[model samples]
Target: MRKLALIILVAVTSQTTWADAVSDLKNYLSSTQSLQANFKQTVTSQQGKIQNSSGTLSIQRPGLFRWIYQKPFEQLIIADGKQVWLYDPDLKQATVKAMGKALESSPAALLAGNNQFERNYTLRPLPSREGIDWLEATPKQADQSFNSVKLGFSQGQLMQMELHDNFGQTTRIYFSALKINPKIDASQFRFTPPKDADVIRE
Candidate 1:
């Protein structure tokens, strides 16, 4: 028991180190203003096989984003910095929430919203994925959903992220051909629900 405790202590202590991890990832982000990229998302349920899809993701500072999934299905998750719209065509339903109120402090809050990554999380390279570098981020304060957040960056672009839920499901996101600070339209974040679509507000 004593030896196991020591091992856990060392692991927890190293996560908050500045010179090694948290600072290194912060240094990388300070150089970029905005980012856009294409991504392929794979979601596997607790007892299900892997499902794949491709999409385009765009992000701008101060909380604005557009996610248009083009493969496997047509879905849209748009955040206009003030409100969020999640539309799924197959279901013909839309979910809506005001910005900064939903998503329970998502990592994109680091890219476009007003949250500071350095203050909320510590950084460390994950050992799980081969040929991929990762950053493990833990929130500094309370009121976060997941215990840890993982960011995968390759070639200096935000390539992947995995949010591990307490229940054991991981939401993995991957990016490709990222374009930094591209000219994105403001209307991309705007929302107009389709007629007869169930609009739920939280």
Candidate 2:
């Protein structure tokens, strides 16, 4: 689940003038200040085992986002600019960490928070596949967990994402019902552990 959160957080990349797809994506990110979407995720392990989950996510620029897992279990990951809180309702536990410590190398962080995403990644426009404009981002730093990430867009909206990890596992995410620049409540980015939950602060 941390992988899922990490994948969504690390969104940095470098770009070239290869195609409109690349420019369109950069434009969309720059213009979009907030968004909400439903997502379906599939993780395929190196051994070929697959796990599926569904969730809803909301993001506001400059270090604020909420990701809620609603299928297969219920969990919440909320980052309120200063700190990140991970709460697992089933386990009755919540973990908290400083945002800088938690998202040091997050790709999604660049995607959602940092407007200057073209900083630490090599971005290439991939051949359109599945009728979706695709862009690939590979981190310049080799010490990261994932090898590369791919983003699929259509009609100026993000439709999908794929992350290939160093361990040979792949995580694919499809987004739907996307609301770009939607009004999201600021409270959603804040989290409070349940009364009975064990709280761990890091």
Candidate 3:
């Protein structure tokens, strides 16, 4: 009888812990309107190919963001509320896509998208690890570039994200010096291709 009671108690406690983690994530999404941070991204391929890059990120909720990669090569991805632009300075090329199509089932959707989490993803809490509470979100859509995403939070602040892609690559991003709800200039989200650059519209 004591053993059975102990098992039941443990299960209940585990469930409550998971629920709390999910709640923390919801509160964070609701409270954060704009955010800026320095980010480091590491990608590991199935064959063990690894690449590391560092960048700065800025986001305004409901579809506005600028992601800049500074190391190794310079690349910029900006969402101007209506269109998403990807520019490669070295290649002198830019690609444009509608915001909805570009962000659908993507990590950018989770961060800078409208607060429609449940509509696009099925979220669940993961076991706490490395001093962070983790949450896993699987996209509901059948066609997605990524298989799943994991978000790690420390003290309710986002710390890390892992995206498992369909191409058998895992991209992990660590965010530091995060400023939540900070004042961000609108120009940050706007992008214009250089006059000499080749622009490809998708």
Candidate 4:
């Protein structure tokens, strides 16, 4: 009947739309070798307190990233493929850890590393919002630090990410002036402790 045909058409259209979103995400992840973006991060605590931070983010594929927080406070988190370093200028201290261990439960790692997405996450298309194609990713491991992550893309560019932590805190990051596949110097991911600073290795 006409009603049955219409139902089938709607179902097919929905499926195609979902597939397109997933495909777009996969292609973006596979093609992006390096990226730079300015970001604003908002964190809401379980008790409803809110905090805001603005930062610049840079990432090179295969386990390299630098997150520089410049406003409110200055902090640097750098992963150099082999090790991860956390530098706090105010404290004059740095902590170093093996990269694998540092990325174990990190959502940032998911964004920066060349991870096998399908192997680690179940990806599904979220209803489009604000003219952005949204994808929701749930970790295969039940012990993940965050409950789930949502990624939003506009015109094939990553624009936003939302992470919900196990502790009920939610962090939302909005990206602006994003540059994909930009040339990044090798030294960008490297970190050296400053003179007279405390360095702790784990």
Best by TM-score: 3
Rank the models by lDDT, top first.
3, 4, 2, 1
Cα lDDT tens digits, model 1, 1-202, are 9999999987775553323344445644676556788888887767766788898888777677888999988999988767888999888889987765434366767667654665556655565245455678876655666667787655455667887666666678888888877787778778799897887886
Q: Write candidate 4's Cα lDDT for 1-202 as tens digits.
A: 9999999987886676677677778777788889999999999999999999999989998789999999889999999988989999999999999977436445665678665777777888777788777888888788778899998877777889999999999999999998889999999999999998999999
Candidate 3, residues 57-124: lDDT per residue as tens digits? 99999899999999989999999999999999999999999976548567888889877787889987
Say which candidate scores most in lDDT.
3
Question: Comparing candidate 2 with candidate 4, which one achieves the higher TM-score?
Answer: 4
Candidate 1 deviant stretches above 4 angstroms: 1-24, 101-104, 127-131, 141-143
**TM-score of each candidate structure, all chains considered together:** 0.78, 0.87, 0.93, 0.89
Better of 1 and 3 by TM-score: 3
Candidate 3 residue runs with Cα over 4 Å from true position: 1-10
**Please, what's the RMSD in Å of model 2?**
9.7
Stretches of candidate 4 above 4 Å error?
Answer: 1-17, 101-105
- Indicate the residue-level lDDT of 25 in model 3: 75
Question: Each candidate's lDDT (Cα)?
Answer: 0.71, 0.82, 0.90, 0.85
The alpha-carbon root-mean-square deviation between model 4 and the true structure, to one decimal in Å, is: 2.4
The true-versus-predicted C-alpha distance at residue 42 of model 3, in Å, is 0.4
Candidate 3 residue pairs in backbone clash: none
